[model samples]
Target: MYGDWSDAPRSLATLGYEPPIPGLIGSSQAMMEVYNLTRRVAGSNASVLLLGETGVGKEMIASAVHRLSQRAAGPFVKVNCGALSESLLESELFGHMRGAFTGAVSNRTGRFEAAHGGSIFLDEINSTSLHLQVKLLRVLQEREFERVGDTQTIRVDTRVVAASNRDLMDEVEAERFREDLYWRLNVVPIRIPPLRERREDIPELVAHFLNVYSETNERHVVHIQREAMEALQDHDWPGNVRELQNYVERAVVLAESDELTVDLLPPEIRSGTKRPPLGMSAQAFDLDTLTQEVVQQGLNEADPDAEDLHSRVVNRVEKELIAQVMQACSGVQTKAATRLGINRNTLHKKLKEYDLDS
Candidate 1:
């Protein structure tokens, strides 16, 4: 291991920086397409726009791009445009000179200058105000910025990678975002599909998260029960991979054995009934088979008689189906009900009866 250590200087170039590997683990066709695109775009200097829902790991793609670029030795700066107030966001992006504002006792370098010869990632770029959009457009067009209080223009060379969960085209139509800036940033667009659309990748994602959080938590959850894995794959993950990771970490901490079980899941997922994949045979229905099932056994001790049995069974089935639909729709009740072939009012009433609405 130390064979070449004594002969070479530890310069940035010699540090042997390999590109940061993405944590994504999936062989599904959808993910393979994204991986191919990522690899192809990594070598270029062009600005990239990553479009995806929250918790879909847009920043990871940005980092991969920076690491694979020729400017791998330079810094990678990330800014969350949605988290800061407008004034603070402006100051953060462009920096400020001494005595520029209340807390400006000294001059400071902005993210752009700090990331000189490297890349800057702007997350939630759609959340920025219109005024800030104009300033940002100027920076992208001129590659220069002035300090908050200084007239001197500072020129910096930095690659930009912007990400947003919202539809920029819709924003343009609504006049909430600048069309010119949208065109400028969307030079090369990459869309990340949501978890539901790529259900086949759920198993791989679940396994990867389990292994990752297990190591972090110092637990020995080496395997997941087949039933548990099936439940994970069938349930609609509204929060996508982030939610799955959280559940896995929770299971690791609460699990009594090395295997993950349905009991370890949150109530919604644990109680959810799995739906068959598309084109699968529809199971034969038997009233007697379902009649023996208990409805909220502990909570509702008043069992339904023959007269109310139909209503109860219909309600129970509807509740379970709606819960899964809501998960797939990311808790958007209107969308969920529509997908379930029911009105919002009917869905809301059932949600309350099932004690799931809250």
Candidate 2:
């Protein structure tokens, strides 16, 4: 059994790395509000629930909060609730004593216990089963728990921070999540805007990713072409920053020169003329030109890639874009077909055509 937790508050200044509190990458008011909320709630113990689409950087915000909090000196544990099964997740969070189950051979300290005097980040908390949620609720309420197959109670003083990419309210309404638990976890809700909603931030995020990856890859790519920037800012980034990061990394690796031109962008993005109608202006269209410009700008410091590798990369980009559009439409054959600008019957044939739907 663990001893009682000390309630003394620690000073944030003692922590070496101050919270790199996410700032407004854009001047947009929505992003500014998000930054302000993150800064304001950084020092609190209240459970924070980050709501956003995938790749919006909820985990980054969570880390910033932990770094700024009074418990900065202690462990910052993270668990992906959606990644584990119910039984495994229970043991992972609350732990199990030796011989607690068939696979349990020794005593274990779960995320909660490991996070004592610190913070535990529960990613995709909505994925937890009701039974597991009850246990979690108990821990949140009592700050105490017992290992599986052990009656001895263990007390912890871990601050909880949970995040989800799904619509939690919709989940609750569908009986897929516990309402009470949702309320408890939502003490300080932080909503991250999707990339499409904050398209203005594309330039800044692009610059940041470019600089980081270029140095890491020993490249000196310094500029972006105007048409390339336009393509980047115009496309609806359904995958958000993550997609952008992948593009930059790929660009750095395959860059023929020190510039990041649109040619480095995936085929779907480069083929701006083929982009599905997003209710945007057609005057901005010029996929190939944009690609050439951006690729030229970022290839200055990057190594040249062989023709075969470049061809393979183009194919990979095509595959990924197709997959993303299908997923965004939730595997709905017709909608996905429409999004991809193909006939429904052709999409049905393509499902088997690409061996994807199977």
What residue runs in model 1 are displaced by over 4 Å at the alpha carbon? 1-22, 273-358
Weakest lDDT window of 10 consecutive positions for candidate 2: 1-10
lDDT by residue (tens digit), candidate 2, 163-273 = 998767767755778888888888899999888888878888888888889999999888898878888888877778888889888988888898899898888787664
Candidate 2 has a TM-score of 0.71
Off by over 4 Å in 2: 1-27, 273-358
User: Could you tell me the lDDT of residue 167 within candidate 2?
Assistant: 69
